[model samples]
Target: MRLPKDPTPIRTIEVVPYDPAWPAQFEAIAAPIRAKLSPLALGVEHVGSTSVPGLTAKPIIDLDVVISSRLQLPEVVSKLTELGYVHEGNLGIPGREAFMWPDGNGRHHLYVCSVNTPNLHYHLLFRDYLRQHPDKALEYGQLKEKLAKQYPGDMDGYSEGKQDLISRLMQEAEALSGFALHQP
Candidate 1:
């Protein structure tokens, strides 16, 4: 039998009710990366639905390793690679670089982003908004659940379905945050 070369290919879009352990899971994934990178990584953030209490989401954890500038990327990538994660370039998002573990390091989406990146801002904005607004989180969770069921095994469709709600929520979040976040 042949196996796919990509180690952590997300083949399906499975959204489930929030698990309380998600924060600990993010820590498990973050700790070592933090230890190794230390001063190089400004912060290893827990972003996406799993970061918000009671928000339904895919089991995957999303983390952003922040750096001061793209100048830090080479060392960041090297250190992460040493930790067994393969650098997957930007994966189309310019300011963020993606990395994936080769084994069962638990499912996660890891990105290295400079402090000024639009991608990083969006991730933080979305997570913070959901964390503070339970009502909005509930709405997002319901939408995600419906989309997950409607687009089983269809990641593209599931992601596409989230655009409208996410955009609206981001706008509200930016406005309430007293700043405007541009979409990338």
Candidate 2:
């Protein structure tokens, strides 16, 4: 019989009331990143729970920097590193390279993805769908709140709990957008 590994100790999940200031905070972080990446970035967008207005989230902004090709990743990473973002590889998600700034700048997540990558499209679609459908966004926010309470510091458990809802939403989003949902 296989035993489960001990959960990595992480800060407890904290879902706060939706803050009107989130967009400005996201822009504050995104602008500098976009300026630095420049022509290399086909698009830089805020894509995540915080992007949806009135959605209660964990107060971390998620930004996607879309590039034109995989060959461009090395230069993109080098440029971002010069600006103080530590490249953390793909973090198990292919086509989306993740990065983290040393603590204190802001609480945020960054991903560099190719323009043609399905993950990039999914992020945008999900964000747009939630923005257009406040009812669904509220439902998702409640689910997140419940899961955060249930799992506490267990990030894996919290994410796992949301898989079903995310899948359902993604399918709906894909159907609405006429694009197949692609896993990354």
Candidate 3:
């Protein structure tokens, strides 16, 4: 698979104070996605680290839009491209598709998937879990900062570092929110 142009190789992760701008930024991006995909989309949600307030992130927003089928991918890609997104295959993660918005600021990571796709929902559930629970969010933030430091320049390594923590947190979220969790 071709690597994404802007690889976020780790450097010290810092859970900076919550930026109130995140929600508005998400809405701005979501509006276009919703409009373009409405006929094909089941729902659109803000996922990933940026979606959680008081959480430090890689400064890139992550959005997920649930569509009906894998066959619908081409259309989704075309539509998103028309709106300035550059398609990027999941590279390694299957059952999920990714895209990068060509914003000079390097703003977002967008994904499209099926409604029945558990991984998509799991990401949303995790985001919601962190949002609703401040302590956990803080803990995750610290973990990220540490992982960033340890895995600097290693994007794959950085992601692997968080796998265990994410798994355990997903369990807590499932129990507390009753959202079904998908093991990736």
RMSD of each predicted structure: 2.9, 4.3, 4.5
What TM-score does model 2 achieve against the real structure?
0.91
Q: In candidate 1, what residue range of length 10 has the lowest lDDT sum?
A: 3-12
Candidate 3 local lDDT, 1-184, one digit each (tens): 9867766543554445568898898899899899988798887888888889899788777888899898888999899888888888975777788887686445677888777777787887898889899999998888888878887777777889898998889899998887666544
lDDT of 2 by residue, 1-184 (tens): 9989768546889999899999999889889888999999987899899999999899999999999999999999999998999999999998899998867445999999998888998899999999999998999999999999999989999999999998999888888988887654
- Scanning candidate 2 in windows of ten residues, the lowest lDDT window is 175-184
Q: Write the per-residue lDDT of candidate 1 for residues 61-162, one digit (tens) a residue.
A: 999999999998999999998999999899998999999888745589999999999889889888998999999999999999999889988888999999
Would you list the C-alpha lDDT of every candidate in the order shown?
0.91, 0.90, 0.82
Model 2, global lDDT: 0.90
Tell me the spans in candidate 3 whose CA falls farther than 4 Å from its real position: 1-15, 103-105, 182-184
TM-score of 3: 0.82
Ordered from best to worst TM-score, the candidate numbers read: 1, 2, 3
* Candidate 3 local distance difference test against the native: 0.82
132: Cα error in model 2, Å: 0.9
> What lDDT score goes with residue 153 in model 2?
89
List clash counts for every candidate, in order.
0, 0, 0
